[model samples]
Target: MPTVRSVTDATFVDQVLLADGLVLVDFWAAWCKPCRAMAPVVEQFAAANRSRITVVKLNVDENRETSETYGITTIPTLRAFRGGREVASIVGALPRKALETRLRGVLGRGAAQGPID
Candidate 1:
């Protein structure tokens, strides 16, 4: 199974922001119902697009600093990073096809054929 690496405040820079390629950072909290609902969709999306993008989870409750830095006022927020910069973001729990379409638009169809690096 594909694992969603937990990103903390300390490692946020190295693991998500500073990383190259397309990185999808899911900002979530344990108690949020929407966050919980989006978990499986995010997981499956991560697995399916493992070669096109890097999917990571950041717990808002645990990574307060990072959450504040990103201005994540929502429970489930998805941000796309490329070249150490945020290129796009989506808030709320969307369906699988919608999520895939968004990712494909950001990463491109050709990215699916190659490694995530």
Candidate 2:
């Protein structure tokens, strides 16, 4: 099953920013084909990394404020946050292996142990 949850502008701060550990926010809209195609990939990644990260989805069309704040000009943007700040971001749909690799590269080792390096 997919472990990803949805967050809105009203909940973005408490859910993603003030959140503990690492949080991966998927900024996407329903109409975007790439975003839809990436859903399963993201869900699988989330399930596999459940112990290390918290995954959530935010629809750009529904939450414009948060999207604008994050300077998201494109869809399917995946952002990783740690210590209430963005530590990494990927701006397009990627395969599971690539996604994991990219995130691991940016987050580095001991990612779940503490703040992102």
Candidate 3:
């Protein structure tokens, strides 16, 4: 089953920005309650959409350079990137259905469920 991998300032470019397709990066920190609350949902979403997108987590506290570059002042900022550019972003902790709807709106119907990879 697919799982949300961790990305850092050192690996962000290769693992996300330069990745082949869609990549959903969850920017968060250990002290963030909302981030913790949204973890399971992110995990499930990643597993369900494994074949369509790559999911990863970046800890803001540990990855300051990447966080500052992205201007991520909020916890649980979800950014969708493709072709080395960010296409969409969502701030804060949204419910599962809300997250799906928002992502679908930006990503289109192709964001449908896929086999775990």
The TM-score values for the models, in the order shown, are 0.88, 0.90, 0.89
**Residue-level lDDT tens digits of model 2 in 1-117:** 559999999999999999977899999999999999999999999999898899999999999999999999998999998877778888999899999988885445443444332
Q: What TM-score number comes out for model 3?
A: 0.89
How does candidate 3 score on lDDT?
A: 0.86
**Candidate 2 at 63: error in angstroms?**
0.3
> Candidate 2: lDDT over CA atoms?
0.88
RMSD of 1: 4.7
Q: Which stretches of candidate 1 lie over 4 Å from their true place?
A: 109-117
Model 3 scores worst on lDDT over the 10 consecutive residues at: 108-117
lDDT of 3 by residue, 1-117 (tens): 449999999999999989987899999999999999999999988887788889999999999999999999999999998777777788999888888887875454232433221
Q: Which model, 1 or 2, shows the larger TM-score?
A: 2
| Backbone clash count for every predicted candidate, in the order shown | 0, 0, 0
Write candidate 1's Cα lDDT for 1-117 as tens digits. Answer: 456788899998898878867889999999999999999999999888888789999999998998999899987999988766776788899988988876666777332343332
Weakest 10 consecutive residues of candidate 1 by summed lDDT: 108-117
User: Which candidate number has the best TM-score?
Assistant: 2
